[model samples]
Target: MKTIKPILFFLLFFFTISCVNQKQKDQEEIKQTVKNYFNAVKANDLEKCKLLIEDSENYLGVIQGEFNFLHKNYDEINPNDVLLRNILVKDTLITFTNEKEKYVQYIIKNDKNPNNLKKPLIITFMFYKPVGYDKIFNRVILENHIGWDK
Candidate 1:
C-alpha cells in the first residue's frame, strides 16, 4: 500500500501540471485570435479578419460607425469601411478564482467618406463567460453608448 500511495501522488501532480499547461495554451490561442481579428481590421484586410470570428446569418454586432452587419458576406467585410481607431482589453475574474479570465474590447470608429477625415467615433465591448454548464469564453456586450462629446 505504501508504494501505491507514492505512485498515486506522483500521478496526481503530473495530471495537475498538464491541465494547467493546457489552459495556458488555450488562453494564448484566444489572445492570438483576438490580435488577428483586430490587425485585419487595422490593415484593411477584411478577408483575414473573418477567419477568427464565428459565422452566423444573424451574427450581428455593431462595429461602431452607424452601421451594423457591415457586409452580408464575411468575405466582403471592408476594413476601410470599419475603422478600428483604438482597442482596449481588460481582464476580469469569472470563476475558478484566478484560473479564468475575461477580455473586453473598446474600439473607436472612423467612416469611409473620403472627404470627411475628422475625429473617429468610440465604442466599447465587454466580454464575459456566459452562465450555465458550458465552459467557454464569449463576449456579452454589457454596454454600448455614443461618446459624450456630442
Candidate 2:
C-alpha cells in the first residue's frame, strides 16, 4: 500500500508539471504568432501574413482596405510600432465546446500626434485549439476597432 501511494503521488506530480509546462509553451507560441504577424505587416508581406492566419478569406478584404488607407494617409507606417505598445491577453471560453481559448488585444495610437491624443486602435485576436489537436488550429482576427478605448 505504501509503495502504491508513492507511485500514485509521483504520477500526479508528473502530470501537474506537464500541464504547467504545456500552458507556458502555448502562451509563448501565441505571443510568437502575434509577433510574426506584425512583422509580416511591417514588411508589407501579405503572403507571410496570409500563411500565419487561419481564415484568411474572412479578413483579407478588411486587411487590404486598411493597408490602402494607411499607405495613402501616412508617409511611414510601421506595425512594429504598435506591437511595441501595450498588449493584453485574457482567457476566453469557447461556448460550444466549453474549451479554454485565448483572446489577445493590442492597443495603439492611430496617428503620430503626441500633443492631441485620440481614441486608441484596438486589435483583438482569438486563438483556439480544436479537440484532439496538439497545437492551435485557428488564429482568428476577431476585431479591429479604430477610436476605441482599451
Candidate 3:
C-alpha cells in the first residue's frame, strides 16, 4: 500500500507538469502565429496572411475589405508599428457553434499612423483554437479609433 501510494502520487505529479508544459508551449505557438501574421501584414503579403488563417474563405472578404481600406486611407500601414500593449488568453464558448475554444486577444496601441490623426487607434486581433485543434485561427480584427483609455 505504501509503495502504491508513492507511485500514484508520482504519476499525478508527472501528469500535472506535462499539462502545464503543454499549455505554455501552446501559448508560445499562438503568440508566434500572431507575430507572423502581423509580419505578413507589414510586408503586405496577403498570401502569407491567408495561409495563417483558418476558414479563410469565410473571413477572406472581411480581411480584404480591411486591407483595401487601410491601403486607401493610410500611405503605408505597418502592423509592426503598432506597439504591443497587452495579450490576454481566455477560454470561451462559441455560442453559435457550441464549441469550447481558447481565445488570444492582442490589444495593440496604434501610434504609427502616417496620416497623423489625433485620436488613438486601438487595434485588437483575436485568434481562437477550437478544442482538439492544434492550430490557432484568426477570428476577428477590431479597430477602435476612440481608444481604450476610457
Of candidate 3, the 10-residue stretch with the lowest lDDT total is 71-80
True-structure RMSD, every candidate? 8.6, 4.8, 5.4
User: Which is better, 1 or 3, measured by lDDT?
Assistant: 3
Cα lDDT of model 3 by residue, 32-139, tens digit: 666676656666777777677677778888777655544443333333345332345567777998876666554334445545454554444445554223343543
Each prediction's TM-score against the native? 0.48, 0.70, 0.66
Each model's lDDT comes to: 0.43, 0.59, 0.58
- Scored by TM-score, the top model is 2
Candidate 1 regions with alpha-carbon error over 4 angstroms: 60-102, 105-150
lDDT of 1 at 52: 39
Over 64-122, each residue of candidate 1 has an lDDT whose tens digit, in order, gives 22222222322332344342333334566646656445554543333343444445433
> Which residue pairs does candidate 2 place in steric collision?
none
Ranking by TM-score: 2, 3, 1
**In model 1, how large is the Cα lDDT of residue 5?**
94
